[model samples]
Target: MFKIKSEVGFDMAHYLCGYEGKCANIHGHRYRLVATLKSETLQESGQCRGMVDDFTNFKKALKEIAEDFDHKLLIEDNEEGRELAAKLEVLPNNFDIVFVPYRTTAEEMSRDVFNRLKSKGFKIYEVELFETPTNSCIYTEE
Candidate 1:
């Protein structure tokens, strides 16, 4: 099998609702994500022969996903999330919010992004999400 991967990084802030510790408070991280794709076949050409696939297309998709979350608040769905966002909205100006269908954890985000790429008919092998420089997680369907 042939594999190709791409990565992107961004900044985000989030708080875990209903948590028992300091995690309940708002915090931020410089996040990075890596997406891998696999294929067993490649186009036969003068410059592209025997390659997995065109890495340019994979990079484009990764860029699109990264742009969606850069410099945004990664909010999870909960009473706290709603209330805090409401308060922020009432400030002098407004900030953009990125809401996940589930908690704003690396695991959930990884799975969500993986599904999104897969739904687009991409040969997604895995998604790796780095919530911190030392902490990261991966999600794969197969």
Candidate 2:
């Protein structure tokens, strides 16, 4: 098998709506997102010959995906979250809010990345999402 990896970084804030911990309050992290792709056969011809995929294309697409989450507030798409987003939108702070389908935890973030890359037709094998330098979540299919 052949595999390649690429990574990008972003900063974002989030709050768990119903959690009972310090993380329930709004917080931010310097997130690191890593994407890995694997293939049993490499491209045998053309510009990508002998490679699983082009690194430039992989990194570019990953950056585009990460760009959406950069410098934004992630709010889960729930009733309370929707209301909060609306309130923030009208505020003078000019908050950038991103409505995510699930809680903005590292685990969910990794899963979200995997799905997003998969939707782009990448041979996505694993996603590693770092909420901090020492803490991370890895999402992959069994």
Candidate 3:
């Protein structure tokens, strides 16, 4: 089996709704997102003659997706958080609201990104999401 990986870093802010601690409040983090691709065969000849996969296109697409979330607020399903996000969406703040289908955690974030990228026709095998420098989560699709 051959595998290739690409990594991109971005920053975003968010507060978990219904949390009992400081995480319930608004906060931000310099997030890191890593994407991995795998394939069993390599092209015999072409621009990627010797590579397991062409990462240039992959990286470019991933970067574009990351750009949308960069410097945005990632709010989960908290009423207060949604209210604040709604109000902020109309303000001068260039806040981007991402309505996640799951809880706002590193784990969920990775899975979300993984599914999105896959839906976009990228051969995504694994996703690593970093919520903090000391904490990160990974999700893989088998």
Q: lDDT values of the candidates?
A: 0.84, 0.92, 0.81
Order of the predicted models by lDDT, top scorer first: 2, 1, 3
Q: After superposition, how far is residue 42 of candidate 1 from its true place, in Å?
A: 2.1
Poorly placed runs, candidate 3 (over 4 Å): 77-80, 87-94
Cα lDDT of model 2 overall?
0.92
Q: Per-residue alpha-carbon lDDT of model 2 for 1-142, expressed as tens digits?
A: 9889999999999978778877877899999999999999999999999999999999999999889999999999999899888888788998988888898899998998999899998999999999999999999995
Off by over 4 Å in 1: 44-49
Better of 2 and 3 by lDDT: 2
TM-score of 2: 0.95
Alpha-carbon deviation at 32 in model 1, angstroms: 1.2
**What would the TM-score be for candidate 3 when compared with the true structure?**
0.85
TM-score, cand. 1: 0.89
Among these predictions, the greatest lDDT belongs to 2
Every model's TM-score: 0.89, 0.95, 0.85
Span of 10 residues, lowest total lDDT, candidate 1: 46-55
* C-alpha lDDT (0 to 100) for residue 137 of candidate 2: 97
